[model samples]
Target: MPRLADIDEISSLVLFVASDDAGYSTGVEFVADGGNLLGPVPAAKS
Candidate 1:
């Protein structure tokens, strides 16, 4: 499982999103949930 992301990690995204470098970034859909959309993993049977 992926570990929790640091504040800096998220802050970096915010910074970039706010910067002019991302001026062309329209309708951006950022997903920083460590791949939560992949759904839960199944448990292994012993």
Candidate 2:
């Protein structure tokens, strides 16, 4: 099952981008889709 992202999870990314730590990061696409972009995970074989 896919897990949903918590508010804190997304907020942390936002906080980092707003902070000086991400100062050099420009024109970057920050994806916070909880690995959804990687496609669905295959089911385990029994």
Best by lDDT: 2
**lDDT tens string, model 1, 1-46?**
4579889989999999999999898798988887778988789999
Give TM per candidate: 0.70, 0.86
Where model 1 places Cα greater than 4 Å from the true spot, the runs are 41-46
Worst 10 residues of 2 by lDDT: 1-10
| Candidate 2, lDDT over the whole model | 0.91
Which tens-of-lDDT digit does each residue in 6-42 have in candidate 2? 9999999999999999989988999999889889899
What clash pairs does model 2 have?
none
Residue pairs that clash (backbone atoms under 3 angstroms), model 1: none
